[model samples]
Target: MRTPARRTAAALAALLLCLAAAPATHAASPHRHRAATLDDLARQHGRYFGSAVDNPELADTAYSDLLGSEFGQTTPGNGMKWDATEPRRGVFDFTAGDEIVNYAHAKGLKVRGHTLLWHSQLPNWLTSGTWTADELRAILKSHITQVVKHNRGKVFAWDVANEIMNEDGTYRQSIFYKTLGPGYVADALRWARAADPNVKLYLNDYNVEGLGAKSDAYYALIKQLKAEGVPVDGFGMQAHLALQHGFPNDVRGNIRRFADLGVDVAVTELDIRMILPADETELAQQADWYGKMTSACLAVRRCVGITLWGYSDGHSWIPSTFPGEGAALPWDENLGHKPAYDAIRNALTAARS
Candidate 1:
């Protein structure tokens, strides 16, 4: 037998817990009108500010909740990659990619396909087996065609080829390059175009933000491709910077140079990593750098947008990938805004004004 007062207190406790467990429904909040999200500010300047995400991350309601509210576009981190989309040579799977596409559509956001061809994360059947030039070309065409065709209307763009250049600016000797020769790039691009002419095709790479040998290699390749009438629409500079190495030199100039070649440029995977145990001083520096990177993109006419590798440090790939190096995003593990967040906001706000 419980007292009425005790029973009321017990009921209240259960209600509080239920509310805590439920995800934030900002639509019903009285305060949804006041705040300006990154995407909103970006659109004012005629660009899209986005983040990369995967299927598993959707399980974290808080993460997904923020993503839906803040981003206007999303890149499927690994769901649309070769490994996930076509594990078997002839067989195909769209389960992972479709989940992300459906999520983005539900949230009223656009989707960018990560990659149709890459040197890594390839299915074993494709990588392990040896092939003649003709044999390899058919497989490559089939893969790109099926993937692009499957997501034709859903994905607005595709990273048609990813990380295909060496640090010294040489073409990476991927299986495609070895078996089908340099023409493989043109062939793959053509196949993707045939599959979906409307989808924008891009060649994405890291360490190309600055004027360096790696970027130079891409410059020459794109020029040649354009001269030959190849369908190269964009160049993706993956701004995966580490504070320890210092920011890339002449980032804006590099973007402009590529843009002059008649292709849109984007900061595809933007993240600035710092050494562990970040102090106030280091964080402040990180914050300033974030603002500078955002400003760089705004300065260039053909620089289309910036997509953070991931928005929260909690979901960032830095810790495990770099070991001792983390804290590489605008938000911390708890989804709290870090100094970098304010810096990015200020940069975009200034542009709007």
Candidate 2:
């Protein structure tokens, strides 16, 4: 019904309005915000951060984000060991360990060298070959020297020994014990300290959260070592727990006892594994468990910090280690924060305040 000139003017005005809004629509798309970095996460809620870091592609990004962030400490697994560090006798390799230490230092994060002596990750060559006591001693010395000397000032703490206790209250028979006897633990600590006197030494282990046979053994061993004036400085409680198993009966008391030993305690490698996809009840239980663990650490003066095993459920070792149980981290695989994370942050923040 309108004239041709009127129609043209109306159409032109509509076109102009559409063009004006195009830029704003583009800016509001989902991918506008930058991905959160480790520093961002730490500043929000983290003190000690860690990842097993199996993938090569993401290791650098993960490390930079974690160590470079406000949270500034790292503990390497399998990277700084005899098997990986010196796969061939007298032929040392620092490729993986070097990367971890370098990344940590770059971000101003304190590096904790995960363990000089663990029975599990030893190279087959070291285990299978027959060597005299002196030869074995020399090999041990060289492995420590190469790894420790490489990151002298950057590395702060070292787990001198790890998981020596069996669930049945006996020392798990390891090649070190089989070859050099129990004195090997002390000897190893002495050698590590001599190599780098500034590095704080610790004994790291799992299943020592409560007064069970495992803890009893660890306590007895430490008591003896203390009497002998061993240079051991701290204890690492690898609190790899599960909600179904229920929280340990006396975890806080156990932590307190360890602190009373005149040594610091750290909840290294902490994760609360849920056996099933967490329902409301399961999630609630995890929150309670996290609260208790954080409370325990808060109560103890020497409990320096707690580090979750991985940042998200997707990267958690639980699915592989315990099939059908994956959601064990504070954040799920897609980076959505979970109730467990919230509980821990709340607990830590309240305690800090």
Candidate 3:
């Protein structure tokens, strides 16, 4: 026997919970409006941005939600590789990468096929198997050929080589380097170009942003690649920056140096992770960093796009992989927009002005 007032309150509570539990509908509040849409962003900024997604179910909705938004492209987290594409040498598995590519194609979003070759997350068989340098080169050729041919035109670009330089401006001594020597990178690019003449190819790396020795090393490689007629098309600067360590003040000069080489430049994986949710000072610094990075690109004709690694702080790979790291995105875990989003939007929109 509940009092009439109590009964009414209980009914209201249940209704509110039901509403909260239901998946969002179009009529929903700011959540829907805040959800970043690809069409809206692309049309508004006329620039490209993207994220790496792993699941197919979320991939479909995320692409649909963003179909025509600021982010006009998408990439797979760990697909389009020897591990995912050809895990057991001869057998190839296109399940995950294909799902992402098809969804982006359906939504008319440009797709960037990440990492044809990387030192990390490589298949163990590729590392462990006793293959001669010739055998390895043959395997590399076949892998790139099949993967490139499979997704040909759908992928707007491919990271033909990744992280080849050490922090101190020397070759990182990857397996390709160890087995077949320095020419391995050129060989991979040649094979990839032959497989898909239309695909824009790039060399991606981190911590080589400013005009330092590392940057000089990459510059030499780019020049050599051009001189050798390797069909190289772009350079991807992995801008995984931080609040504590701060960004290189000469970011603009760094980017321009590469673009000056007659190749496209992209901030391939841009994120600024703070140890904690931003304080007032941190927020201002982040906004400034975002604006500066954006300004540099907008000023450069060949700087094509700026892609965030993930959409939100919650899903950022920083925390799990780099302990004590968090809050490295333009959105929070709840999908709430942050100051960084507005900062980037303002930068891009203002850059056009």
Best candidate (score: TM-score): 1
> Please, what are the lDDT tens digits per residue for candidate 1 over residues 1-353?
75799889999999999999998876668765659899999999999999999889999999998998899999999999999999998899999999999999999989999999999999999888989988888888899999999999999889999999999998899998888888888888889999999988899999999999999999999999999999999999889998999998699899999999999998899999999998898899899999999999998988899999999999999999999999999999999999999999999999888
RMSD of each: 8.8, 7.5, 10.0
TM-score of model number 1: 0.91
**Candidate 2 TM-score versus the reference:** 0.83
- Maximum-lDDT candidate: 1
Two-way lDDT contest, 1 vs 3, winner: 1
**Residues 251-302, model 2: lDDT tens digits:** 8889889888888888888888887867988887887787778778777777
Clash count for candidate 1 is 0
**In candidate 3, residue 217 scores what lDDT?**
91
What TM-score, to 2 decimals, does candidate 3 have?
0.85
Q: What lDDT score goes with residue 246 in model 2?
A: 70
Of 1 and 2, the candidate ranking higher by TM-score: 1
Please write out the lDDT profile of model 3 over residues 1-353, one tens digit for every residue. Answer: 75799889999999999999998756557665585453354345555767666554353454336433546777776767668888888788898788778767776668888878888877888888888899989988888888898888789899989998898888889888888888989988999899999999999988877778888898999999999888899999888889898688898888888998989998888888887656878877877887787778777778888777876775678899778777787877766777887887777666656
State the displacement of the C-alpha of residue 189, model 3, in Å, after optimal TM-score superposition: 0.7
In order of appearance, the predictions have TM-scores of: 0.91, 0.83, 0.85
Mark the regions of model 3 whose C-alpha exceeds 4 Å error after superposition: 1-46, 56-70
